[model samples]
Target: MKLPLAARVQEAGAALAAEASRFSGYGWMRGTSGNLSIVLDRDPLVLAVTASGLDKSELTDRDVVLIDADGEALDSDDPRPPSAEAGLHAHIAARTGAGAVFHVHAFDAVVAGHRWPGGVEIRDMEMLKGIGHRANDETVTIPVIANDQDMRVEAARFDEVYVAATAEVPEVPALIVANHGMYAWGADVAAARRHLEITEWLLRFAVATR
Candidate 1:
């Protein structure tokens, strides 16, 4: 008998919580500013994601909430809200066909976004290989969306700007929110982590080269 999707979501939550904590240890999540998720299913749209306002260092499996594609809580764990940015996570996952998404309020993303209103261009860097950046343009461009208090508005804005293509903007594994942070995604948690690391690295690399 196959495990129920809910059960699998729960399992994924447990695993993701550990990974999120590790990210916290890297000083990334810093006081609940970051969130992580694992997609249970894409069609029915179930996800195991961190809860809102919880300290990432102390996050447990219970801190991970199951939500639908719309970011509505589904696991019925005393109605505690999902991450405030869950909608953005869902939007990225849906748009990119990612199985996992990770968001972090890292320093490089914030600095880079503040410097570039249009987008951040990472050119001629070896680190680009980590996130699968391959293009004739010889550079990786990560879009930046201005942060908004109303996450719904921000999510909608994200929907408008974040289209990936080879000849156009190109498919970056990540995008930054101005003065907010970056969201990185991939086919799984490990891959998403790699994307996050590479994206953050590219920002720092850009700064270092300057």
Candidate 2:
């Protein structure tokens, strides 16, 4: 359904806030650890993203800041700033055409990303089907990039890795950065949430099995 820009902003603001809170409750975003973003529209380069340092569990729609495509803060009543990972979010949307980007540091993803050595591959799991992969018979390779303190550098590294991973497994929907967190995206918000949920489940399973 088409919505006015203000309504769209509010809708995206609420959805992102709720998603952040849910992830917090799941222990993925504990201690203000994760960030989320949704595209308001492509043309004007508007995005609604979580403000930095806010406790995810109590995040409000007021905490979601609107930023331009280049990551500049747009004029808004909410004076809070976007998260440090704003660059990462913008990079993903630009590179992947993703409508929503969700990042979290669940124990499963952190442990798996660290222990998996080269990269984590999920094979022969029913949950693998959730990320739009064709079959469980094949391995969905999730590249685990080393985390960088400088997000700009990290974003560039992720861009390269994302391109390579997509080239390798075009259907794969997410990637993990070693010792950092996991990123999942999709054509829209609901699809992105499913991808994140399924990937987290698969990562937990892989870690538990090994």
Candidate 3:
């Protein structure tokens, strides 16, 4: 039997908290710097997102808030505001049909975005396979957009740079905001986590080498 929407939301909250804790341990989500989200409904696009201003490492299962496709809070009783970047998460979900999205303030991601404002070009690395790219001669460009205080504007900037996956190339599952951080998505929470980790590792490698 399918779980009720309310139950699904609670389940998503717990799952997001666990993922948040993992990222926090890596120092990628220092203080309350990062956010994670899971899709709860696709028809109208509901999401369970981490609440604003909470320590990522200390999140409980109840720490999440429900938000709509426009990033507006759907649960009026919940006083917590969704993460400031929730709109970007929504846009990515709507655009890519991703089930989960993660954003982290990893040092290497910020550094690489600053160094490569256009986009980061990576090629011929075995780690590339982790992000669904070829491990041999294929080149993948992780899109980077300038940071904006307004997430709506930021989402627009993302749309300007996003490239759809072609038959010959898979879509880049991640993006970087200049001087800010990176956002990664996948079919589900675990896949999103893996993509985020692999993308961060690639950024670290790029920063170290360049």
Candidate 4:
């Protein structure tokens, strides 16, 4: 049976907190610079996003706030506001049907975005398989979109560059924001975390080699 919404929300919050803490420990979410979210419902598109301005490393299950498809906070007694990038998370979830989305300010991601403003391309690397790409004879571009303070503008920019996956090629499942950071998503929290890590590793390799 499906769990109650409240129960599901609590579970999502805990899962998000765990992932946030892991990323924070890696210094990817330094201070409150990054945000994470998980879909609590798909039909109405409810999400549990990390609260704004809190130390991600210290977050508990209660540290998240519920938001709708538009990133508007739902009616709740919780006084915390959702992350400023909650809308982008909502946009990604809506566009990709990803169950979880994570944004991080990893140094490598920023460097790679600046180095490859058009997009970061990877090919013939074993790590590529980590992101659903072939380990050889295939090149994939992780799209890079211009960053904007306005979430609407950012989402619009993403729409222009976003490419759907095809039968012959799997989507990279991540993108970089030029001069900003990276956003990675997947079917669930675990997959999102793996994509995030693998993409960051790939970026680090690209930056290091260049």
Candidate 5:
């Protein structure tokens, strides 16, 4: 079926919603603890982001809000706020050219965060290939920064991590925040979904083995 651009966007939003539900089932986004976003357009800058405090499993098109690069609300008569971590998502999108960003608080990521103040190293795992990076015998050190409540501070920390990380693995798709959650992005919504799922799987495996 030839869906209009709006319909296509809605479809993508629905896909993101479904992904959120799956994450919830896995206990990744428990008790309204996570957010999801997809780029509707990039040139003029429009992102379809999840509204704050909504149960992800019950998400609908109306639950999504359109925002600009500055994170200003662009569409929707509803005065609903975007997720609290919207700034972090915006920062990643602006810096990485990612078409979508997904954040969730999975047990592995949170537990690993509590242990690794610097970061966690996942080396030689075949799953690394799923994150659009080469999986080799070499160690893939995924840096984990201490979690912060201030979004601005959190965003700045991410900026530092981005610069340092690009110096090593310039194309890694996801990052971890200690005791917080994970941030994964990709070239488009589907690609972003792949990155999120792959990173989550890797973390789950790492935790299980450790």
Candidate 6:
């Protein structure tokens, strides 16, 4: 009893748009600096992603573009051009099987990353449970990668660190790019929202307490 692809995409697009609007309320994405995406189908690989340069607060499903695995727009000949970081979304989906990927340039994330260029470690925080930390005093280290203007190059650099982390910690819900921003993904849109919210929460907490 699965819904048709178009209907599903429409539903996902609406959800993504709503989430984007909510996140845009945050000062970080207030100027259209964040991007969000939700997967529609995996076989042919379709994604409903935010179109580039549009104000997230003003976006609805209309601004979501359906793109393939290769980041080709499937919906419109001029699909408003998907976000510049669409490639990162595609890569995260491929590696994590995540249904949604959310990226934001929060001041807290930048501050935390700058404060700890190697990465940020949040330990003994109750909020860490949001990202699935079990132990009360568990330490969670978010690996940070250097940034590149060419996102494809950035994606490759991310893969190297992401791949290497598999040996020690495999279920990485979010990653930070040095002075860039944070990317969070999860099984679906709701989970992605949870991860994104708490990751930003954790960053803000880290910056505040330090």
The candidate scoring highest on TM-score is: 3
Worst 10 residues of 6 by lDDT: 163-172
Task: Report the lDDT tens digits of candidate 3 across residue range 47-137.
Answer: 9999999999999888899889999999898888888899999999999999999999999999999999989999989999889889888
- Candidate achieving higher TM-score, 3 or 4: 3
Q: Write the per-residue lDDT of candidate 4 for residues 144-172, one digit (tens) a residue.
A: 99889899998998888887888997777
lDDT of 5 by residue, 1-210 (tens): 666767866876687788788888888888778998887776877787888898887777667777777677775676888777877787788878888899998788777767666777788888888875668866766667767777788878887766423545656678899878888898887788788888878877887888
Query: Lowest-lDDT window of 10 residues in candidate 4?
Result: 75-84
TM-score of 6: 0.91
| Runs with alpha carbons beyond 4 Å of true place in candidate 4 | none
Clashing pairs in 2: none
- Those runs of model 3 whose alpha carbons end farther than 4 Å from true positions after fitting are none
lDDT over C-alpha atoms for residue 181 of model 5: 87
Consecutive 10-residue window with the lowest summed lDDT within model 1: 132-141
Cα lDDT of all candidates, in order? 0.82, 0.83, 0.92, 0.91, 0.78, 0.81
Best by lDDT: 3
Q: Candidate 1 at residue 159, lDDT?
A: 77
> Can you give the lDDT of residue 164 in candidate 5?
29
TM-score of every candidate: 0.90, 0.90, 0.98, 0.97, 0.87, 0.91
Q: Write the per-residue lDDT of candidate 2 for residues 1-210, one digit (tens) a residue.
A: 889978888888789988988888889999888899998888866788888888889987767888876676786666777888787788788778889999999889989989985779877887777887756568777778888767778777876666433544675678788888999998888988899999999899888988
Rank candidates by lDDT, best first.
3, 4, 2, 1, 6, 5
- How many clashing residue pairs are found in candidate 5? 1
